[model samples]
Target: MHAEGADAADDARAALLAATGAATLDDAVIIARGRPRLDGGEPAGPVWKVRSTRGLDQEVSRLAKSRGVSKSQILREAAAAYVEAS
Candidate 1:
C-alpha cells in the first residue's frame, strides 16, 4: 500500500511537471510554491478568494512566471478583460 501511494504521488508529480513544461521536479516544486508576497502596504482593495482546478492553477503559475508577474495580477487582468467584454 505504501509503495502504491508513493507511485501515485510520483505519477501525479510527473504529470504536473509535464503539464507545466517544467524542466525538472525541482522546477515544478518551485512553480507550485509561487513567488512570495511583497512586504508592507495595504492591499489596493478588499481581498477576494478564487478557486481553480489543479490543471488551471499549474498553467497560471507557468504564465505568471514567464511574464514576470504575480498570479494575482494575471487573474486580475483576466477578470477585468472578461468584465469589459461582457
Candidate 2:
C-alpha cells in the first residue's frame, strides 16, 4: 500500500477503538452500525437489490395505483411481497 494510504487506515483504526471504548453501550453499538436481532423472532433474512431506479419507480407507481395506496407505501409492500414470493 502507499504510505499515505497506510497512515489513513491506521488513523481510522485508532479512532474506532477509541470510540468503542469511550462510548456508552447503546452509543457504541450505534456508532458501529451494529444491530443484533433478538430471539422473539428469527434474524432478518438477506437483503435483495433493485437494479434500475426507473423500473422500480414505474412498478411501484403501478402497484400503488392498483391498490389505492401511496407510491412509497406501495413500493414497500411490493418489496415485501417479492421477498415472501421468493
Candidate 3:
C-alpha cells in the first residue's frame, strides 16, 4: 500500500475502535447509562437502540410490563407526570 493508503487504514482502524468504545451492543441493547458523547451527528442520549430488531423499541413496553399498564397508558402517565413535575 502507498503511504497515504497506510495512513488512511490507520485512521479507519482508530475510528472503528472509537465507535466500539462509543457503543457496545450486547443482548440487542446499546448501553448508554453514562456521560454523553458528541459524535458526527446529534448528541447521544440515554436512548439505546435495539440493534437486534429492525425498528425502535418503545420504553413503555418495559414500563408497562413492570407497572401492569398498557404501553399507551404508560406513555400518557409518563407525560402527565413529567408535565406535573416540570
When sorted by lDDT, best at the front, the candidate numbers are 1, 2, 3
Q: How accurate is candidate 2 locally (lDDT)?
A: 0.61
Any runs in candidate 2 off by more than 4 Å, and if so which? 22-33, 40-86
Q: Mind giving the per-residue lDDT tens digits that candidate 2 earns over 1-86?
A: 99999999778767875755423444444546643453357976565565668977788767654444456455566677999999
Candidate 3 or 1, higher TM-score: 1
- Candidate 1's displacement at residue 40, Å, is 15
lDDT per residue for candidate 3 within 28-77, as digits (tens), equals 12322322244556765354333423232355566554444444455556
Candidate models: Cα lDDT each: 0.78, 0.61, 0.50
Candidate 3 global TM-score:
0.31
Top lDDT prediction, candidate number: 1
Q: Encode model 1's per-residue lDDT on 3-79: one tens digit a residue.
A: 99999998998897886567777777766676555345545566789789999999998898676557898998898
lDDT of 2 at 69: 46
Candidate 3 Cα misplacement greater than 4 A, ranges: 1-58
RMSD to the hidden true structure, all candidates: 8.7, 12.9, 13.4
Cα error, candidate 1, residue 8 (Å): 41
TM-score of 2: 0.33
Candidate 2: minimum summed lDDT over ten consecutive residues — where?
22-31
